[model samples]
Target: MNLQYKTIVVTGGGSGMGRELVIALLKKGAKVAAIDINKDSLEETVRIAGDYGINASTFVLDITDKSAVEETVKEMLVRLKSIDGLINNAGIIQPFAAVNDLDDKTTERVMNVNFWGTYYLTKTILPHLLTRPEAHIVNVSSMGGFIPFPTQTIYGASKAAVKILTEGLYAELKNTAVNVTVVHPGAIMTNITQNSGLGGPKVDNNDKNNMALSPSKAAQIIIRAMEKNKFRATVGKDAWFLDKLYRLAPKFATNFIGKMMKKSLAQH
Candidate 1:
């Protein structure tokens, strides 16, 4: 679907890739409703929008609230006129620890923000999207969703749910005008750990291997994928490489990642 003159709603637009996506969409001449739990961050996003600020609107609300999501969508439709696209970009990572070592509250919080939040927004806005001539839905899953990681089991599980959910939607919407794309982003430069109140080394896009893709780059790829109505999109070199590797050798892929992570953690 053409993004030009269309209206898109982006969750977690306060910062990171979500913020970058909002800006990128504006550049494509699309109106955006930026939703986030942080009012200040949303304000910053709108402020940086510059001349496109007029076309960009911000909503400060917790996506984990089902009632709030429904009401927000209602208000967003009134403000944006229509919802042509929905991007489930807001997510959080669990603390770096084994699953059994993690607390129930932390796990639930991770699941609520990453999985249920996406579900609620999609459920609320999907009916409206189907009513349109053409629409797109983009859900941001993580590499951890496909490959096992030592410390982020809960995070991986939540994202894996998103992956399956997106795929199921794609399968069901095959004959519809609405397109669904699931994105598996490798390590992109974002404050996900900080935002989640967890501590971890963030990926650097400048790495020689180019393992980490910038948020802007990821957003660009996502926009392109949506236009082409692709079923799945992978964002970074690491993501693409690992995805193929996992498909070929799931056991080896998991073990390799585990060893590398162990070494990295030891060094830290």
Candidate 2:
């Protein structure tokens, strides 16, 4: 779908790739409703967006809150006239731990923000998106979506679900003008880890091989993929290589990742 003149909603727009995406969208002459749970960050995003134009709007919302999300959608339609596209980019990463090692609440929180939040926003805006002549839904999964990474079991599971859920949406809407794009981002330096404040030891800071892409680069790649209406995209060499490996050797590939997780856990 052409972004020009369309209204796009980007969750997690306060920072990271989402904020950059809002800037990119504005350059294409699209109206943007940038949402985040962090109101302070939202203000900062909107302030920075001033150079972009008046078309940028901010909505403070917790995507997992059903009533809040529903209400926000209603208000957005009334305010912006229409929601032409949605980028389900709000997500949190669980610290490395075996599923059983993570507390029940911890696992649920990860799933809620990473998977259910995406699902809620998609379901809420779907009706409004369908009303438009052309609509797009960009679901940001992760390399973990395609390949299981140790300790990140919940994070990986949620992304994997998003991968399949987004594909299902794409398949279901194939005949329509609406488009769905799923992204598998390799490790990029961003606050999905820091901001989440999830428990357990963090991933090693020196995993240079995996942390190849920057948020800005990731945002650009995402926009390009959405423009092509690509069904799936893998960002960064780490992510790209992982996707290929996952497809060619699912068992061994995951095993390697599992070992990495174990090492990280042992270090912690």
Candidate of highest lDDT: 1
Query: For candidate 1, lDDT tens digit of each residue in 10-71?
Result: 99999999999999999999999999999999999988888888899999989999999999
Question: The CA-based lDDT of model 2 is what?
Answer: 0.88
* Deviating ranges (above 4 Å) for candidate 1: 199-211
Supply candidate 1's per-residue lDDT for 174.
87
User: Residue by residue across 157-229, what tens digits does model 2's lDDT show?
Assistant: 9999999999999999999889999999997767676778854444443566655677778899999998899
Show the lowest summed lDDT stretch of 10 residues, model 1: 202-211
Candidate 1, TM-score vs. the true structure? 0.96
TM-score of each: 0.96, 0.93
lDDT assessment of candidate 1: 0.92
